[model samples]
Target: MIIKRVIRSQNRVIVEGKNLVKKHIKQGPGHEGGIFTVEAPFHASIVQVLDPVTGKPCKIGVKYLEDGTKVRVSRGIGASGSIIPRPEILKMRATPRPTVAGPKDTPNESCAGEDTRS
Candidate 1:
């Protein structure tokens, strides 16, 4: 594996790999000598170099099969899943709503913004 790009921020580092995207440039109809290229970047966090046997995080472990292919396994360490509250979960759903409403449409508009209690 080749290390392409790396960015360090505080206690974390972000890395980009070349395998993320394949660049292709093709000449258009009656096009000049301008080269066209497509570039795509993948998140480094999506990939990990782990052991072949276990599907966990690992510092170093690799094995090649008889078919000349390499296998990897996680190094036995990974981030834990997150836990969210029920109210917070509902906030992510979609709900229908009116397009627009005028001041006269709702008689309580003015009162709603004001504090009724002295």
Candidate 2:
């Protein structure tokens, strides 16, 4: 299975959404009291970064650019041993972007900030 993403890499690099084991837990202060699937750590030697273009698992190689700058190149088909651009990973918004809520055409025009709490 393809790795969704890498959580962390150290002595044991962790691969996300892999080898998950479900475990039950009682109601706790922080926890919501339910079963959760967590990623298990795997050996760093086994996991390898996939090729940028082909998306296939391949060994990484360093090649020099015309500017004399060394860059990583994917040794995959159609790659032609060319320098690969750094992958762009768009970060997800922690919270959804704030939206403006337009008026609902209520009976009164000045009731926009009226509190309806009991």
Candidate 3:
């Protein structure tokens, strides 16, 4: 399972486990508490960030720019071999912005609570 979030202060990382364990808690006066199914934390050493280019878990490598700015790169064999910032990804979407979701403004009911939604 991959790590979903990292809690550095507590030195723990929340990873997607095989199953969600339900934990019960007593509600305090100021807390809206209940039985919650939350992602359990694992050892930080076991967690690894995936390479955006190859989509594989690998050790992160840092390379400095000419102006002394540090950048992270992937060591994946199938990745683009370059000392760079972010990988190049082209998302060729089928639907453009205009055809996609947006607030449909009706001409007549431009005032008050006449919503122009389906």
Candidate 4:
């Protein structure tokens, strides 16, 4: 199953076509009440990462390369022990840090222990 999203704080993941649940929405202002089918979050430990080379689910282990770069590899039963490349989405930042301070941003002087309320 493909992982749709990860809830790191809760140690849960929403896997595609897994752990489906029915959500009951209450009627509220400008909202309609209905029963909706949605993907529920499950413990991350319950799922296994598939080995890219073997195309089978396998336990993952951390391996360090010669250059000291750490990577995840398949390590359990019938494992091919191939390195697993990180998904591109995981490398992307959900919200990039602002390069320039906005109007609501605190001035650098105050942040650096300088009193701005003189």
Question: Backbone clashes per model, in order?
Answer: 12, 0, 0, 0
- Quote the lDDT for 117 in model 3: 84
Q: Write the per-residue lDDT of candidate 2 for residues 78-99, one digit (tens) a residue.
A: 4555556655552455477646
Clashes of 3: 0
Per-residue error (Å), model 4, residue 94: 11
Assess candidate 1 and give its TM-score to the true structure: 0.23
In terms of TM-score, which candidate is stronger, 1 or 2?
Answer: 2
The TM-score, computed over Cα atoms with residue i paired to residue i, of candidate 4 is: 0.63
Q: Output the number of the TM-score-best candidate.
A: 4
Error of 4 at 5 (Å): 1.9
- Cα shift from native, residue 22, model 3 (Å): 6.2
Clashing pairs in 4: none
Off by over 4 Å in 4: 66-68, 88-118
Q: What ranges in model 2 sit over 4 Å off?
A: 1-9, 29-34, 76-80, 86-118
* Per-candidate TM-score against the hidden true structure: 0.23, 0.48, 0.44, 0.63
Off-target runs (Cα >4 Å) in candidate 3 are 1-4, 17-38, 76-118
Cα lDDT for residue 22, candidate 3:
89
Residue range 26-113, candidate 1, lDDT tens digits: 6678865444443344555655553335434445345566898654323335522222113343356456565678555766556677
The lDDT leader among the candidates is 4
Ranking the candidates on lDDT from highest down gives 4, 3, 2, 1
lDDT of 4 by residue, 1-118 (tens): 6888999899999999999899999999998999999999989899888899889999989999999999999999899999999989878998998999899998877779666586
